[model samples]
Target: MKQAKRKKLKKTHAPTLWIGLFMMGLLVVLAVLAPVICPYDPLEQNLAEFLKAPGAKHLFGTDQLGRDLFTRTLYAARTDLWIMVMAEIAPFIIGISLGMAAGYFGGAIDWLVGMASDTFIAFPFYLLVIVIAFASGAGSHGIFITYLLVGWLIYCKVARGQSAALKNSEWIAAAKILGYSNIRILFCELLPNIIPQAIVLLMTDMVGLLVIIVTLGYLGIGISPPTPDWGTMISEGQTFMTSAWWLSVLPGMFVVYTGVALSFIGDGLADRFR
Candidate 1:
């Protein structure tokens, strides 16, 4: 009876994991096949092909510059995937380390780490990112770097909480009593336990990155044009929105759909993690 109930519970929960996996797989496929699968040269501009609607030749249509929206959209996925990935990485490392230290040490180190995270959490996250991006003016790399500075604070807090929670656990106490080092427990035990929450956070943040990259481009602080960013495509398309609504709208839809799908997956994972 116990085994049967356990099996049933597992079956019920399986779909959520599957859905998250499927969405992530879709994102990967889009990113990898972007170049070859796209219909036209993303960077190729033709005044003649400019502002063409979805039709026999062009599926997503062309922008005002006659660049293929279809191709740009695909490549744009590449941008979105990596920026969020980078954003997560930058903060994950520092935050996790500080959090683990703070949680384990529980003194001045904790205070210092808490202060830093609070400072960032105090910032209007997006606004700070924009300011940093413009100040550095390092283009895409700069944008990612700047956001990383802001994005990791949440992770720090999560890690700190997890660390604090675990410090009281029997196994952690047992390790300490057994003369096991703090560093050993920190990496081997606490780190692994906290990662599920981090993964859930990563997935949710990945969805938001699509919009963030586009917004930066919209603000003229992200990757520039002729490079085939979806944000750039939208920016270019807006001028022709009355005459060539497809130009801006198509790419926008692609961004939104993928992002929403990812968000669904993220939220499900987060719930399961809880």
Candidate 2:
């Protein structure tokens, strides 16, 4: 019975890592090729064509602004991808570095770093980003910074815990015995080992992050108009849901599909690693 349960659990988690990698790859391709593939300018609007439903010309239909939903979504991919990459890297770099430092030395710095990390972790992660978003005047750049502040703690916590575990390991002791520099051990040895774990965690959280960013846009608290964010698209479509379901539905589908793909890839990678 226990074996069967474990097998079921493995099957469930398999797709997460795989889907995550696929999503990441898709986002990269979109970022790079969206310009050529999407014929219409994402920001360009046509008043005459406004409120058009999904059709042959405009597959995803026109928005309230008569913008090509397909084109806008493709371009919007750029923004979403940028946010994800920036948000993840910013935290990954800072948090991992600080965490390594804190765990390796094990002194006053460790306590201070640990306490600060814990304090941030105590709060709801999304809430912190939202507050920072609003306070910083609420735009892409602002939101990006807010994301970094809110997200770094996770990486830091993980890296710190991982580093602590290796502090007394035989390999680490050998490195120390050989008088390896702190930089060599931290980057060449410690950081490299911990990164796979970080990547897996990042994959797991990417979808949730997408949802939060979308919600912020939907609520008018995220990327401003003219940007055509997915959340904002849904928000704009809400009033006309009965008449223009396509406006919201298409973008929402993109969000869900992309989320699913990334989640699957992430799960697969995690399973393989495990």
Top candidate on TM-score is 1
lDDT of 1 by residue, 1-274 (tens): 9999978977787687677678768867977898767767777889998678888788787777777777778888787667767767777788788888898788899999988887878888788878888788836886677767876776788899889888999999899899988899999889999988888777776666667888888777888766767787778778888988987787788678777677667767766776
TM-score of each: 0.90, 0.87
* Backbone collision tally, model 1: 0
- For each candidate, the alpha-carbon lDDT, in order, equals 0.78, 0.81
| Alpha-carbon RMSD to native, per candidate | 2.2, 3.5
- Candidate 1 weakest ten by summed lDDT: 138-147
Could you tell me the lDDT of residue 264 within candidate 2?
76
lDDT of 2 by residue, 1-274 (tens): 9999999988787656655666767866876797887778888879999899888888888888888988888777778767866667777788889989888877997999988877777878777777877887656776677667667777888888899999889999999999999889999889988888888788767777788779888878888888868888889889899999988888888888778777677667667677
Best by lDDT: 2
